[model samples]
Target: MAIVVNLDVMMAKRKMSLNELSEKVDITLANLSILKTGKARAVRFSTLEAICKVLECQPGDILEYVAD
Candidate 1:
């Protein structure tokens, strides 16, 4: 996948647990895990916004584009 999800990195940087982020973002643990593990095929902008809001980061902090 050219688009990499760096959710785990941000979470670690912020010292937040998956459980805590899920609660703050009001998302399911399984879904967040999928995103964190880079298994999610798509993410809604609203969801991404909520995550960024909770993590105190911009979208670039969580998502990265790498050329193949």
Candidate 2:
């Protein structure tokens, strides 16, 4: 995938657990897990906002675009 999710990096930096982030972001653990593992095909802006808000990070911190 050209779009890479850097969720794990951010999580480690924040020292937050997936379950804790899910609760704080008001998202499901299963869905957040998919994002953490870089398995998500797409992420809604609203959800992204929630994640950024909870993680105190920018979207760029979690997502990256790499040319194929």
Candidate 3:
């Protein structure tokens, strides 16, 4: 199974930067980078909610499932 995070794609579509998102989401750059790079093992619902609100996107827009 493979789960892909389209964070960078959404950020680009929204014309937002890493640092900007970090500040808006109140997430550390390191942690956000981990999530953005699809290295995160998990993410809290609240964190996800904040991201969605800040980016004006849905969780489905940032997440994808692939059969491997």
lDDT of each: 0.97, 0.93, 0.96
Output the number of the TM-score-best candidate: 1
Clashing pairs in 3: none
- Candidate 2, residues 1-68, lDDT tens digits: the string is 89999998999999999989999999999999999888998899999999999889999999999999
Off by over 4 Å in 3: none
Least accurate 10 contiguous residues by lDDT in model 3 = 1-10
Q: TM-score for every candidate vs. truth?
A: 0.97, 0.95, 0.96
Q: Which residue pairs in candidate 1 have backbone atoms (N, alpha carbon, C) closer than 3 angstroms, thus clashing?
A: none
What would the C-alpha RMSD of candidate 2 be, to one decimal place? 0.7
Better of 2 and 3 by TM-score: 3
| Every candidate's CA RMSD | 0.5, 0.7, 0.8
Number of colliding residue pairs in model 1:
0
Compute the lDDT for candidate 3: 0.96
> How many collisions per candidate?
0, 0, 0
Ordering by TM-score: 1, 3, 2
